[model samples]
Target: MEAWKEKFVSWFATSGRMNRAAFVKRFFGVNLVCMAAVLVIGSRVIEETGSVFASNLVSGVLAALAAVFLYSPMVRRLHDIGRDARLAQAYLCFGIPQGFLLGKVAALPPGSLGLYAFEAALAAVTLLFIVLVFHAGEPRRNAYGAVPGRAAAAQQTGRKKGRRLKKAGTV
Candidate 1:
């Protein structure tokens, strides 16, 4: 139970390492939460209200919060794989806005260059994140703290004791 808490909460931190399992799990979990929020709030409430500003406000607030929560975990996940966290800036700064732009462009005449461009960009960004989330992180710690699976246990005990416990097959 405690492990689960730590794993999920790691989404809010940008300076740690996260193994593939934790990254994949949180990736899906965050998507589910975002979908639920949009369905419940965006579709049901905002649409029914029929106010464009209200809808934008609600959705924008939700999107911003989601980005805030997702940004750190994404950076850390990149770090775990021995990559610069700055790589995530592309997705955070451009990919997400491009997604919204894609939707609007969809209403434009078919075969619009802008629509195709946005679609291509969004696809590339999604693929990048998919690959990153599934890729195995550096086996031993590189520079971004220890391997997360081991780091959590090590954090619970003194480093020496943690090493001993790992050797004893208890951690």
Candidate 2:
């Protein structure tokens, strides 16, 4: 229980760098969970209550809760790439509202221009985020923290320097 507490607390702490693997796990894992929850729990709520608004309310709450876990990991990924955490805030400012708008527009008749536009915008934003997560990260320490396994790269650099010095008879 204590270990779980620490893990949960760390989820929101955006102070350290995270590698590609950790970033994918936390970000995609939470997103998958949230999607599953909305699909499963939300459908059940609607079926039982017979109110789509209530179902949407439940889904929104779940998404907001999931966002609590998502924002920090995104910030950590930005740190790993030597970028500012504030970049993640754009999702909070725009993405959430866009999501709501998307849902509303999704109900429109097929071939609606607004639906396609919103979908394209959402896809573009999602693609940008996907590229960020998958982009190769800096493998050394930065303002946030050292990436795991990056120390070996630094050691290899040091060894190369030592070899050069030896060849030049400086050491």
Candidate 3:
């Protein structure tokens, strides 16, 4: 738990050195929280007044904003995992269209089996890209500097530990 907190705080602070597992866990965690909030809030709004359009619109807008805020951090996390930020663009290219189609299918009256099928297919494709991003190759010396492993080792060894000077230009 402490490690998780540390990772979260560090990512918040510097957006640095997240491994594959960490990146996915954090990404999924954030998305899950956002999704759950949307579901709950949207359901409440619809149940209270039965305005599907309004509820859906609000949910969509919130989700889009959340995604906008999340994308940069996620890309940075991917960078920490040694992957290119361009991989993040995959969702924009593929997932958005699929999601739009799914939204349309969901809005259908009934007999929307095709929509569900399409949704399943989209989910599979999205998962595939996510897996690809998680398993993407890490560069040795990225623009962010050496990988986390080396930095952690250096921190542990005290070799690169920073120290305060005792007297101005002396020591």
TM-score of each: 0.74, 0.74, 0.60
> Where is the poorest 10-residue window by lDDT in model 1?
94-103
- Model 1 residue pairs with clashes: none
* Per-structure clash totals for the candidates: 0, 0, 0
Q: Candidate 1 residues 1-171, lDDT tens each?
A: 999999777557788787778777877787789767866887766558887556555666666566666777788889988988777777777635643453366578878887677777768778878878668888898888788878777667787787899999998
Candidate scoring better on TM-score of 1 and 3? 1
Clashing pairs in 2: none
**Which regions of candidate 2 deviate over 4 angstroms?**
108-117, 149-171
Tell me the TM-score of model 3. 0.60
| Tens-digit lDDT string for candidate 3 (1-171) | 999998666555434555666566666776787788789988999999899876767677666655554555566666765666675665445444442344667777665778666766668656744764556536575775567577778776664233433334434
lDDT of 2 at 162: 99
For model 2, give the 10-residue run with minimal summed lDDT: 94-103
**Residue 61 alpha-carbon offset, candidate 1, angstroms:** 3.9
**How many angstroms is residue 86 displaced in model 3 relative to the true structure, after the best TM-score fit?**
2.0
Backbone clashes in candidate 2 total: 0
